[model samples]
Target: MDQIIELFRHLINPAWIIDNGGLYLLIAIIFAETGLFVGFFLPGDSLLFLAGFYGNELSASFHDAPFVVLMLLIAVAGVLGNMVGFWFGRKSGPMLYNRKDTFFFKKKHLHQAHDFYEKYGGGAIFFARFLPIIRTFAPIVAGIVGMDRKKFMFFNLIGSFAWVFSMMLAGYFLGKKFPGLKDHLELIVIGLVVVTTFPVLFKLLFGKAKGPIKTEAAKATEESESK
Candidate 1:
């Protein structure tokens, strides 16, 4: 935990990156976090926030490297990451569906994502990007479902930009105003995750109740047609 927190702090410090290796590390982390399924556990939101927070720090310290540039780089990384993830999904679609057990595949997770996609369509792609664990699986499931490529791309771009921009901006403003936020950032992040996930939870519960109702209605329609 301490190591992770330190890493976050380092990323936000600016000098840690610019003086050390530069934007390459930032770009690689962003790409891996979004594009690779194994990267679902990576700190996407926090990393963006830290990037922004560090931007503030760097601007004050070095008086160079504007925040807008940092935002642009992160945004581009996120967009490209989603594109890579989409292509990965498309390539692995058959293997994902046909084989239940693969080297790193979990059928239950795949089914859950598929169900969410079915209920929400492309909107799920955008919405899921905000919801931690689900975000990683959403795109892959969309590929498996063979969602329209153009439609998926539109939603993917929107979600990528929105997620990266909102978190980074929040980090910049919040970190500047309340230095204490830097202390308890993890808890705040968890709270954000919970809040974002509420709608999905509600939909899952309500959907169960409505399922039988829809089934009965369908049966009634069939009987009426027979008559």
Candidate 2:
């Protein structure tokens, strides 16, 4: 357990990440977190933010690679990751989710993603990029549900660019201006996680899930009665 937490922490630390793998690590992590089902354990929001905040620190090492190129690579990784995830979901379908739950594997997230996709459709794909767990699963479900390829690509492209660019840019600019923020990097990551996680937390605590499920179930009952 301690080892797992430490691994996750090391992965989330922007300095450690860039120092070790430089740009490639960032691209790999961004792709895994956004595109792969097993990637839910990875932290995407904080990673992007830290990458942006520590952009100079990262690029300062690469000598040849410009800062903008690094950011673009991260964004592209995020985009491609979703494309990979979409195809995985489309091919695997819901049956892929039947495995038993564990610390790293939870079916609840799949249900939540399903509900979210059902309620919001394409919009979920765009906005999920901002949210945490939801972002990881949204594209997978979108594929499973047979969303039109054209529509999925359009939104996924838009969401990927927006999510990566915005978070990375925010970190870049703020880190440059504040200078002190680097010291609080861990806290900033935590804060970002909390903010990104609030949407799903709200649904779980405030009966949001029950409302949707009950409404749908009731409608089904009514249809049966009418028949």
Candidate 3:
């Protein structure tokens, strides 16, 4: 936990990256987080927030690049990562379903992705990008289900840009308004997680209540027609 937090601090610290190192690291992290299934555990949202928070510091220290440029680069990295993930999922689509005993590819993950895809449809591609566990599995599920390539790309791009921009901008603005915010960054991060996860919780608890009646009514109509 300590190491992770420190790493997060370092990545966002403008002083840590004088030149190419910062850019490369940021891009690599973005790609891994979105493209690799195992990378779901990474601190994507928090990292973006921190990046925004430190944007000013970086801008002052680095003359060759502005903070906006860095943010744009990060945003582009996130978008490309999703595209790569989608393609990877598509490429491994068949093996993901058929393989049973692989270390990296678990059946349960695939099933969960399937359920999310079923429950939310294409919207899941966008919405899932906010949630932790779900976000990681969404692209893989999209690929496995043979979701339309153009449609997935459209939603994926929109979701990635939205998420990256919001978090980064929030960090930057908040840091500017309240310099002390850096002290309580963890709390802010928690708040973000809560806000993002609430929708998924709402859907799970109430989605059924909204549909069972209509389902039963349809079933009754079909039975009456048969009789």
Assess candidate 1 and give its lDDT: 0.68
On residues 100-219, what C-alpha lDDT tens digit does candidate 2 reach at each position? 877765666767887888788898899889888788888887877777889998998889889988998998899889999778887888888888888878865663332212323345
| lDDT score for residue 103 of model 1 | 38
Worst 10 residues of 2 by lDDT: 207-216
Model 2's number of clashes is 2
Q: List the residue pairs that clash in candidate 2.
A: 52-172, 53-171
Question: Each candidate's lDDT (Cα)?
Answer: 0.68, 0.80, 0.70
Candidate 2 yields a Cα-based lDDT of 0.80
lDDT tens per residue, model 1, 1-227: 67766775675454576675555677777777666676665656656766666566644443566877767777788777777777877777656556655433555555566677777989988887777546777877776556788998899888888988898888788888888877776677667556766665665455443221122334577899999
Over all chains combined, what TM-score does candidate 1 have? Answer: 0.70
Flag regions of model 1 displaced more than 4 Å: 1-22, 58-63, 97-105, 186-227
Q: Compute the lDDT of residue 172 as modeled in candidate 2.
A: 89
**Any residue pairs clashing in model 3, and if so which?**
none
- Winner by lDDT between candidate 3 and candidate 2: 2
What would the TM-score be for candidate 2 when compared with the true structure?
A: 0.86
